[model samples]
Target chain A: MTVPRYTRLIQSLPASVPFVGPEEQERTRGAPFAARLGANENVFGPSPKAIAAMQAETLEIWKYGDPTSFDLRNALAAHMRVQPQNILVGEGIDGLLGYLVRLLISQGDAVVTSDGAYPTFNYHVTGFGGIIHKVPYNGDHEDPAALFAKAKEVEAKLVYLANPDNPMGTWHAGTVIAQALNELPEDCLLLLDEAYVEFAPEGTAAQVDVEDPRIIRMRTFSKAYGMAGARIGYAVGAEGLIRNFDKIRNHFGMNRMAQTGALAALNDQDWLAQTQAKVSQARDRISRIAGDNGLTILPSATNFVAVDCGADGDFARKVLAALVARGIFVRMPFVAPQDRCIRISCGRPEDLDLLAEALPLALAEARK
Target chain B: MTVPRYTRLIQSLPASVPFVGPEEQERTRGAPFAARLGANENVFGPSPKAIAAMQAETLEIWKYGDPTSFDLRNALAAHMRVQPQNILVGEGIDGLLGYLVRLLISQGDAVVTSDGAYPTFNYHVTGFGGIIHKVPYNGDHEDPAALFAKAKEVEAKLVYLANPDNPMGTWHAGTVIAQALNELPEDCLLLLDEAYVEFAPEGTAAQVDVEDPRIIRMRTFSKAYGMAGARIGYAVGAEGLIRNFDKIRNHFGMNRMAQTGALAALNDQDWLAQTQAKVSQARDRISRIAGDNGLTILPSATNFVAVDCGADGDFARKVLAALVARGIFVRMPFVAPQDRCIRISCGRPEDLDLLAEALPLALAEARK
Candidate 1:
């Protein structure tokens, strides 16, 4: 009955899951949600060509995918306007962030991010025993200048900034991020997470040199390409930094159909444009829905809208719970001030109609 | 031009790949392989049911996979006859091995493995700054007794053993392993990688209790199930240790189609048995091909055969290069004595026909 001896660090760490998935919630409730938009997944789906390509490649699933992710890297390089060596494709930004954290953070290393920015990034940092310094959001945006100042104060090795940030859906223009890089500390690397860049306005992607080692931009097909199920994401950075990822990466850890599907998705610009249009319509519809309910919506450049719940975190939580109770899946920011709102992702008209029907009733229930 | 401040351990590691896929070799040669017999990939392909399931689920690739992997875990639990709490599904054995290494190994921690065993295991151990103690294989078989003795001598926290070993295609009966457990040191965890167990003879899977805390059994869909590109594997260990994976796992990292396809694959045992029969026939055909070329093949309980080149490591390398030149993708073990054997994975009858045609010419090239 003797137990295996785990390492001290692992022994000290608490068992944690950054997010409990919708499927688990569904299982617990013994029923699936009517509208599945809580996780910010693009419900519209991937390009038809990607679906066709993946279906075609299903028979090739016996063979291991390219260890180097050769084709995907070349395609992403061409798309990002960078050399192939500047891009590293991985199992979504979540997996890449874990690898990045492992590469930089040893025990007691300092890292920085907005207090309520992506929790998965924070999980990776803390898992590696890194000390985190969090700066509160400036208004609804993740304040890049504040994050850099905190990184400097802590002598952090890494700082994470999500452009067109999650939960809030607000973003700074490319020029703002390009300027904010000047305040980032000497040894600190800015993790510029652009997971929602495709849904954001033009110029939202920072205009940094691909040779800038100070920042690595992570983008995902999970958002605009509508391939969250594919689990593919990539980071673009200075050639040398991207090369360093090979030091410990699981070389053959990629899925073959994911590579095929993502490549097809990248080549279908018309389909992407159509998806963008639909997302734009859904965003507008969601805003109107918020306004009709006498609630105000935050300005958003991403697919999701944050509707102010007219009170504090507690009230917003109650509304969120009520919506969940009514079979409309939605989420809210976990931090104060920002937590006064419920975040709703751009869904199909039918899905949003469910939200429309549920909100007022949910609000009245919350008012109780 | 500042470089990212990577951790000292990461800085110390050389960028390494355990195995390069056959696709990379084809790209380098500007030709596709006539016989893809390397990398232990099944050429007969996955179950038709699995392929159909994967194709059907392609359009649903818009949502992230069930982070909990609820259905797959429950299915794996039912198939393995273990409690669901004892299972931990992950991104293939490579990815799961990485997580396990991270959980147990710190810088300079002692670990043990056979010298010529799976390189990926060594890669993960070294990546985590663990000190690996290698014991030589005894008479072409991985000496479990020697591995356990070394684990005791070095006070290793982890000992890796691949039953139905790769490269040599050798295996011990399950009862041999159950007896070997008595020699394994207390406080040491046995990482029993059974990736090829389904291809091996009956009783090849060890008879250890699912509640045993001293061992963790890792199996994959990559081998007999023929879904290597899906990047799916699972570990069965004691409930508490299996629960520990939550502390650092990327909860939502799984691909949706993979989960669906693997569940379908698991449910089709009839297809699995048919694939096993095909593998057995291919192994016999490979042996006959080796014998026709004045070579001998190792007795295998796996989906591959190791043909003795009757020469040194350099000779085997020459033969491997010659085969590659002839568009035959085959590999040889890297360590001494074992290096005299070029490993050939079971392939389709047509693929084996190409191997039969090329072996004599490759041997002549090696002699030259």
Candidate 2:
């Protein structure tokens, strides 16, 4: 029997997932995780108002969402002080990344990212047949200067930098990123992923002009807004660049509940402030728990902390596996040096108590 | 100020939306549509249980949806009597079509479709730089033989056919479609979009082997399941073809609420029967309305009916515009012959009552 033909690029790609979800892990383990702190999900949950909004929209699920996402875009524009044309909302930052890569990366084009940064971005670049250039992070933070220099050297079509970077939970100030933008190659676009910006300190957002065609900043409701399950995010850039997303995006991809929930979340700044404060307290508690266990925690600007196991990558893997075996879901960096740490998202006190109870046993098991 | 570089194909394409949603028209006119029958959405809404499931999921929106969609996929596999590996759930059939086109259609690859059947499919094909070969619809129904012949003639990589088709709301028997498969080129994959199959008459779904590598059938929760705004759909095909979607699909793209809602929807077969009956009644009412206006209505096996205006395409266009002006939302075909009719969706009696009240005036206005 003849198999259906796939494109040459598709033929070359192995069927794989970038990250196995906690739910998948739970299924394999035959039980739910005791502390669901993996995947960097905000365990504090979405604002009550956002949940109510989504619930209200549940009855109106028959009508397809507005393909243009008009109300949400207008709300975002007003909130961000940019024109609606400057924004493009999609399924999530992951979905928007796919569209951006599809628009700019033809086969054989070069793209750049940190060696162990967001794998989903790398997946998109490679999926579209773009050759990827990897740069190493400086200490725990993404070195923007190194990324820009490499982009110029490689003649890269796109360069990805995530502020308050994942896995390490490190961040650079907004002004630093704005200054680094000057070194960006004129022909290369900077894909500044700010998925975690909502949890970072003041001035964490890049100060680049909204009309700057050289950069597109992506923000998500998946993090601090606590709507990761809703799968909603938006990209902000020059109108020319933003409008190009229309050429390839699934125009009706946004769920109706997501659109409504995000708008309500955006409107509730008080809830955002309260959530941030709670995350901050949880981060302190996690740091304390790490210190108590004789482990060092990386200073985190986001909701997650990378606790140094004070050993090599192999030891860190054992610790991560042991934690999972103990029904605590925590992930770690995939590359070396960074892989010496285990990444843990901040959770409520009760959840953290479970983590605190599991960590010592996990460490002892790894040592044995 | 240097502009970001878009790929050559992207540069060649104009930024356009596949469909102008009813919401956009409402924004342009500054008034809500009195009868929203334009987008073929099931106005009866989703099952109450589906709504409850979605609402329950709202509070847990912090966690990302299961990337594998294991629960939903297993549920669908059981419902369809197919293996879990045979099903691939996606954002919607629209998103899946984009992925399918991307998998098979490299630049300049030839694809076949009816001239005016499903513009979104055409959009995806062209977005990936596929060359489209269009065959005219045979009478009101999509001509499967003509499409297969065109596919062979052009050495097309993909051939798209929508059964119980959109806009024209016409369908052929499953046995006829199954027989037409013999004429399809061996190397060309048949993309059978069964988006409306649930509303079609019994024996409408083609009896194809699930292991048939030559075809993939797509179904959606947006139709008889009444969850269009939820944005969930699935494709069933040979295991090999189904596995290829994992190589390119957004692994975490499914919304948690959507996954829960669709599972609830699938479990509620009683709701499905009631919805089908409601749609059949609405179709009869619409047919009677067409008769009252001295118009001929096409025989419909789907939720909508195409009413022939007894004039040319231009007259039909005027009638559609008049209906829109009278606060009734309806659509027509884009190509000739079929464009001589306006498509009206199955709606609640109250919604159709508004349509009934406006049809005579719309006809009078079009004549003027």
Best-performing candidate as measured by lDDT: 2
Chain A, candidate 1, TM-score of 0.99
In model 2, state the lDDT of residue A4. Answer: 78
The alpha-carbon deviation from the true structure for residue B355 of candidate 1, after best TM-score superposition, in angstroms, is: 0.4
Write candidate 2's Cα lDDT for A21-68 as tens digits.
998899899999999888889988888999999999998899999998
Q: What is the DockQ score of candidate 2, to 2 decimals?
A: 0.81
i-RMSD per candidate, Å: 1.5, 1.4
- The sequence of per-residue lDDT tens digits that candidate 1 reaches over residues B109-227 is 99999989999999999999999999999999999999999999999999999999987889999999999999999899999999999988889999999988899999999998999
Model 2: CA > 4 A from native: none
Question: TM-score for every candidate vs. truth?
Answer: 0.99, 0.99
> Model 1 residue A365 lDDT?
97
Clashing residue pairs in candidate 2 are none
- Model 1, TM vs. native: 0.99
- Give fnat of each prediction, in order: 0.88, 0.89
Supply candidate 2's per-residue lDDT for A95: 95
